[model samples]
Target chain A: MADTTWLTLAPAFLLGLTGLLVLYVDSIGRSTKGPIAVLSLLGSLAVAGVAIALPDALGLGPAGWSFVSFTLLGMFALALFVQPGSQNRRLIAGLSTAGAVGALGVAAAFLFTFDGEPVNPFGDALVVDGMSLLFAVIVASVTAMVTVASYNYIAEHSYQAEYYALVLLAGTGMTLMASANSLVTVFVALELASLPSYALVAFLKENKGSVEAGLKYFLVGALSSAVFAYGVSLVYGATGSLQLTAVQNAITGEFTGMLGMGVVMVVGGIAFKTASVPFHFWAPEAYEGAPAPISAFLSSASKAAGFVIAFRVFTEAFLQVSESAGEFLVLGADWVLVFQILAVVTMTLGNLAAVTQDKVKRMLAYSSVGHAGYVLMSLAALSGGGATATAKIEAGQFVLAGGMMHLFVYGFMNTGAFLFIALAEYWDVGRTFEDFTGLGRQAPVASVAMTVFMFSLAGLPPFGGFLSKYLLFGATVNSGFVWLAAVAIVNSAVSLYYYSKLVKALWFDERPDDKKPLEISSRPVGLYAAVIFAAVVTTAMYGVFGPVSDAAIEAAAALL
Target chain B: MAVDTSYYLILSAAVFCTGLFGILTRRNALLFLMSVELMLNAANINLVAFSQYYGNLTGQVFALFTMALAAAEVAVGIGIILVLYRNFEDVDVAEAATMRW
Candidate 1:
């Protein structure tokens, strides 16, 4: 009921501050981890600050419980972090995990506290709204999961502080990306998210795959950003302003060529980030080569950020461009037609490519691409672009909300799937689909979690993925994009075949003779914790689907 | 009178094209990095030119941000390239082709 606008920034602030603190401590010495964790304990409680700051907030129920549990979690962290020995791996991991989880808690808290009104605390540079808060929760949740999984995944690696710091930093950038209201902020926030990602992908400096993938990812990323900057210039040239609302106000069909080209180029740049087809070549290689936890971070949290920018730019910045286009919106049409084409191609190509992959990571990478297509359709479904009618616009928000909910679901299931990979990698389980044979018998609990992930990703019933995809497609259809929905449904069917392949290998196939056994690394507690946490949330999504759906609707409606 | 905005755009376009060609043809990582810089600077020229033409400081300010982005990109780019050379024993991007591109 209160303003809670500045409280919206708590998550970004906590993660970013923790990132700097971790790096500075790592520079000083190894024993600093315990202190870092204890210090961040205060930062974590910044979430409870929502309860403490707002009147009658303690009566809100969850706030009081969250505060109590947060304190307990800090105590638990203290017990683990202060353990003896230099290069205290637990300490750094604990610090990062604590920081990320704190960010997640704050984001979740803000979701309830935000009054659903758009607040531009920083002029047109940034807007903190329900949509941004929702994205912050997604990013922070994924970051928390990644940091938790990285506890084990990164032990053998050095630069522990740098890795965690970059993860947190990139997350800060990503949350900012969702809030960016102008072209300049969007570009800057994008680069902020991307630069660290390039580094994180190459974090395994000695590994040839990591370094090579890093190079490829960096080259592609640099080129796309250059393209994005050019598009911004063209748009500025035409409209004389970079602010989203101002751009919409300035739309008058003058410099249509510049506007059109800039819009397409900007979309192209976003495609690169989302790893949609044409710019998706790097995604498979990067996911395959990078540390699996980092892969999950990029695929889940970072990709959501990419879609957030695309949604904001088109719907908010170019809202007027569509209505101003004259005649049927997509008949002979505008960039909306281009989005329709992209939505179909990206989904189909992603699913088809996913089928041919033997490596589990690479397969998931392609599937990651497929999911992007589904979300892109939300933007494609945007109130039929040029319709001045209020009902048409509301229908547009429905589909957009569907996409947001899908991303929320994705933030869980996809991250869970990739964390399973990290668990496998940590256990030295072999890489191919064939290697996954008989893992079911090896780690039944984790395997079941993974089965949930696979089935969920394939959009099977009784899982979160099914409901989210259903909502997305249904909204698209209801919005009068029947053909688009048809293509997506077929693509969805094709996707099932590949997603099930891993499930088949997990439970059905027999281990090859003389294969290194899964029991070698008995249990990675961090991995199990992260994977199971994701699995629980993803499965619980079904039960809580109503609230999430309504929240997403509210968020999208606010944007429109 | 100064050069026209159209001419500045033309020059930037030429520069951007050259950079794209370089990145495409030259396998050397350093050359590739240089090419990316060229493309970013091309965006810079456009921003500055449009700033004067549109009579707004936003474009001019944005041009500076582009420069900063380019610098940060180059920093990361060169670091990755350095790693590439170390592992592959060559700076050639194509040399590290263990995976299918």
Candidate 2:
């Protein structure tokens, strides 16, 4: 751990390498589809198999199993999309190769990272630990799914290599964001993640909706990042350092007005990234208009990256300091109350807006915002400082872990829902509740997968979402924020109404009599595989909740 | 004599507000990008001023980084605006709103 171990950097490098290779091969106009497909199949199988078998040999314990699960799931998703005979065979082959390579990166991340032992590869500027790797798993897995699904989603599109390369690049950026421990790294990584995403959102340049969504997304993103940069400068002015630990030590007494402004601006910037209230405007338009897999990627993986930074900065830089002595709660209580209010308003507004939406995509967008509110509970729970940082750590770990676990679970269930949309889009199945009618009879398997996603997203009992939601609220109550927990519970109940609408539309409603659709063409193999893979993870998460929760709690403990 | 840090702070604040005003008032997509650049540069000024004040290179280095990042953002922004104009036949952001905000 002390030596300069470059082992941890391999995963991100591999992803970037694959992305470049795809672009290079495409530029050179090589039709290496047969070999590419063969290599991807063999590579995915080998990585998955090797990771599963080596966990015991290497004594990775529970963490190894976690790594194995990611590898297996990623390979399984890739395995499904390996079929041949598509018009965009080279595109599909190249993308699948990139995805399998991404999975290989996840395996590398797991192999290098051990449980309870955090690795700092580039000093404190970057960390290779439970929190970062957990997020890496989420981002990389979602990227894998998106790459596979986009095989069909953008099948005939001309810029196939660019599409996959941008995705892998963005995935690399999100992974870096999780590990960034300095403001400089954080800012750079944010842009690295976002720039490619703008192009991806507007990938379908011919479509006005896609173009418009990209413009709005770019405008908002540029504005927010400027705000964020100014905020970082303010913090630097107040504290005289960019490092989190230095900033933590610098914030000794009451927050100066400068520091206060810095904190608010910083939070504002992060809010836009997570699609929270007041900054969530682009989410609906972007998600509704862009190809659905990108929507899935941004909502699940990108959002998790934002929260990981929030967790890191607040814990390492802000929350650890301001310890109280005897009389009362101290400097830690200030921004926390602000966070609490934001959480309540964001969750409530997101759900209420979702209820009024007629378009399913827009509704999912708002629900993503609502879920952001739920994850915000982690920050909200660090309400007061203890006598020492250790005391604060103890008080915050359970509640913080709740949000972490929720994000982990949310990554699966939410991505599944959006990928279902991708599947429907692939079929040119119409949008909206009515459009979904009788389609359940058409594609029973994908519909059932969608049902699992909806049920899980609604936090129904016996589903994966329920456990994570329960843990989040339960920890909030334990943190003495019973009111926050109450609001969250009520929101969950209201959310059920909308989530079930999709189910009812799929099953109970009759297909419209007048418009008889033509017979279907060949199946969208990639979309179905990705959707089902997500669905399987959504359900299968239940069996391994114990290890997942432990890992999340362990991860949160390091930051707190 | 070196000017006080507060003077630089005030200058940057004024620049930031002006940029914010342009963003609020302008409809042109290119103008919006220009406004964002002004805002980002306002931060760059703060960073460079703070580095001088703190006697450290971190802020100065980040300022350099900020410059690069701004240029990169502008490049992406221009590409997006070009597409917007191609699709909507206008560079105004208002014209680009096919979906209800």
Candidate 3:
């Protein structure tokens, strides 16, 4: 049993080792980008092979191992195809991809194998469960896609090594956050993910926009984290424990204003991570100014991490508070209602703001915020349990599963949309709507892929996004929050206007007379491959919703 | 007179509010970082106070971890601030607004 536990951590260790090896090779100055990339890719492939052959090593169930191995395979492909000729760019991408794969493998192993009961590894400070694993898959996949897209996007930038390393390190932090079983673990992991990301957002130091974005992101991030830590401290004061289960046990039958304040602050801090309003001020600027690939990483992976941790902590620790005390009942209800209101406001504000943005990236940033609202709707539904305990649990599971499905679908569609933007940047197209004029005529393949992504993002039918959104809203209605679902439907309608604007620009606008056909840029293969894969999956996900939703339900059942 | 845990909690709360106020009002990047540090330290104070009152080591240990994380945050925060200084010729947060809505 002990050996199995140690083996569960092997993937993360291997990833760390690979990162060190990459750094060592870079420092030695004897290897070029090509050799480093090749070595990292091989290393990742070896890890994937080990994960498959020794599934019991991590004790992750078969499903967990499959996801882990798939993530690694994806990372390997990302490294293999990103920036075909550039040694430096490929090396950075390879290292980051390897790290993400390693983390994903660990998460999957632990998540899949977890018996719906929390596995308290390392003195119960970290947990391996369904929710964590689901998030692990989401975050790791996002990192892989972003790295694949970054191959061409950051090809011209210097300090390629730092960029990739930071990206991987940030991913590691996020994976850690997903499994954090204690408030202390959550704080450390959140910082670990966020600190690196702050640097990544400002990676293009030469660009004024990038620098400004980084500073604002850092300041806001630092403030929110500090507030979160204070909340942790307050919770510790109230419960005398940082371990979540222990805190939950301690707080039972007790009610204090201090505890209520702690819960509020903690939720507030998580809101910043999700970029939900009124805490969402930094997202648009950060997404707009950062490199397109990093924006994708932040919006998709980082946001998913936020939601996962929020789900873990709130449901695990705070959800049952309403049952224990009369005085605290209002506090518990407030928490639920807060999510309900946040769902409406976040989606509405995001869609409304997105409609007005001229810059495509900015519009997408607002749209991402709106998606955060939709995902929050699931949490709101979870809180609005039915009469009986069994009924409540069933509703909670459905809501969580629905939310997870949406996140999974969002990962593919959102990343694909951002990659399309990266392709535009590669061709020197501006980021505004006008810059995309007549793209369909110039680049038929890319335009088609972009249209699919946009449609999926807008929650159009026959796409994964539509199915996931349907599940989410359906769960909300089942939980008796019909109004929230209605709000979501209205928000979806508003979102279509902006998403279709991009489509209109792509097909309807006239191409400039002097403009040439949109030729594939120097590193077109990796970008095209990643975009096409995401597009295909967005459409194909409709068929696989059953199994995926089942997995999500099972995972949610474990958490409950 | 022995100082009670509540006293420490109150102190931490006061310090936290001050830090939050500074973050909201201060426009200088360096000062903003300092305000964040103040807030983190306030959390540390609460952790230590609660550790003693609870007769447990977990809160203390978490406090130590918080300290280490705060240091790391400061290190990165300073690096970014230095870069901001170099690029914008000033560390004023207000001057760094290049990509507003």
Candidate 4:
């Protein structure tokens, strides 16, 4: 047990050490770039090797190591291919990628090797289990992809090392959040992840839009966190415990108004992170104004982390309160009903708003909001009536698995789409509908890859998005929420209109006579490789849905 | 008459609302950040009050963590505001609306 405990923490520790080492190397002001990059690459590979060597007793199984290794290997490649910039920029980016890779490797190792049963390490402050592992892998993959894609996006920027370090640090915080078993850990982990992201959004000090994006994002994030902390206090006051399971046990009796209010506030705070409606006002501006790779990181990895933590707290802790009450109600309100309403309104508003946007980045941002709604539908489905506790548990697993699968698929498709936007930026194309005109003729490979991402995002067949959505809708229907599924399907259809608009712009719109065919100034091999890899994984995901779904089901079953 | 947990709760709630109001109404970026800090401190008040009532150290420890987090947030917030000031020559929240739907 002692050995497993230390082994489980080794990956994160190693990654953190790498980050500090890179900063140290930078501070010394010697010829440090080459050494820093080499150190980072080696550190990532070592983390991967450690992840695989961990014992089964450690709870990270083979499946977990595979995912962790895959992410780290990708990061290693990113570090290799990221063209060195003048001076220390390349070293900084390399170190950041390495740190992210190392952190993700640790998360994967801990999550996969985690026993099917939950373990409360750190005196119940942290839980290592299937759900956390699943989300950890998703978050790590997104971080790795974004770091690789950013190699070219931020190549010209001066503060390369800081940028990469912040990215990796944010990723570490996310992984910690996924495993956090107590409210205290949750709050700390959340801030750890968020602080770095706030800096990353405003990385381009000279760019007005970047600065504004950082400020708005930071304000919203701070507000939500404060609200969340208040809720935690209220929960502690009501239940006298910060451990999630202990809280669950404490709240199973007649729910007090205070507990009810606290739960609502907590959910409200999380809503800001997921970019759900009523709190989604910041997402569009933030995504539109930040650098393209940072946008991808926030929209994909950061959002996934929010959803995972929400899933852990809501399902593991709060879901029981509603269940033990012997009704679908909690403190004068049906919690499921609230989620149901939230799901419908969020998707409808997001799609309608997206349809009116001209800027591609802003439109994608709104579409992401719509996707959040679809995932929320799975949460709502968790409350379906069942004849027995076992039946309810089974249904919960299906619904949770559906949500997990959709998020997994989304990490690739959405990141791929944003990386394409980065590619356009590299080609000096503007970030508008008109900017993509004649892209198909000019950059055939990139245009085709972008089209694939668009199609997948629109939930077209033979792509990962369609299958994931199908599972999500099917989960809802099986749980007897047919109307909710209907709403989701309609939202999916509405989403197609805007996604197809981008595709049409790429193919049918005429190129201006004055504009020359866009050319890649510096061949950003890392950017292209990341986009193509995401696109291929998305396209190929159709063939592996069976195994993926089974794995998700196994992970979900472990939760119950 | 001694103060009770409810009094603390009410006080914090009022403070939280005031902070929210300030955030919604304030136009200066610095003021917005201050309002956010106010909101965070209100939560800290709740944490301390709960800790005293419950006789558990968890709430107090959490409050300390919250303070550290708030400090980190403020530092980052100030840095961003400085950058915003540099670019726009002002810190008015209204002027930061460069990208809107």
Winner by DockQ: 2
Shift in Å, residue A68, candidate 1: 33
Chain A (candidate 1) TM-score to true chain A: 0.87
lDDT per residue as tens, model 3, A122-149 = 5587877677777777788788777777
The segments of candidate 2 whose C-alpha lies over 4 angstroms from its true place after superposition are A1-4, A30-88, A91-115, A321-333, A384-392, A513-519
Estimate, for each residue in B1-101, the C-alpha lDDT of model 4 and write its tens digit. 38898899899999999999998899988888888888888888988888888788888898999999999899999999999999999999888778762
Compose the digit string of candidate 1's lDDT tens values, residues A1-560. Answer: 54444555778768876775565455335454556555555555666565556645546544344445455443544343322222656777788888888988888887877788787754678888888888999999999999999988887777787788789889989999999999999999999899999999998989999999899999899989998999899888888899988987787778888888788779879999999866888999999899999999999999999999988888777774232443223211276778888888999899999999999999999999999999999988875533455656678889999999999999999999999999988888878998998999888999999999999999998899999999999999989899999999998888899888898999998777877666754788899999999999888886778976887899888766
**Model 4: per-residue Cα lDDT over A153-249, one tens digit each:** 8877766656676777687777778788888888888887899899999988888888999989988888899889888888888877889888877
> After superposition, which runs of candidate 1 have C-alpha atoms over 4 Å from their true positions?
A1-5, A30-86, A321-333, A383-388, A514-517
Query: Cα deviation in Å at residue A236, candidate 3?
Result: 0.6
Give the 10-residue window scoring lowest on summed lDDT in candidate 4 chain A. A77-86
Error of 4 at A94 (Å): 3.6
Please report the candidate that would top lDDT against the real structure.
Answer: 1
* Model 2 pairs whose backbones collide: none
CAPRI accuracy category, model 2: high
Going through the candidates in order, what is the number of backbone clashes in each? 0, 0, 4, 8
Candidate 3: lDDT over CA atoms?
Answer: 0.80
What's the TM-score of each model vs. the native? 0.89, 0.88, 0.88, 0.88
What is the Cα-based lDDT of residue A360 in candidate 2? 84
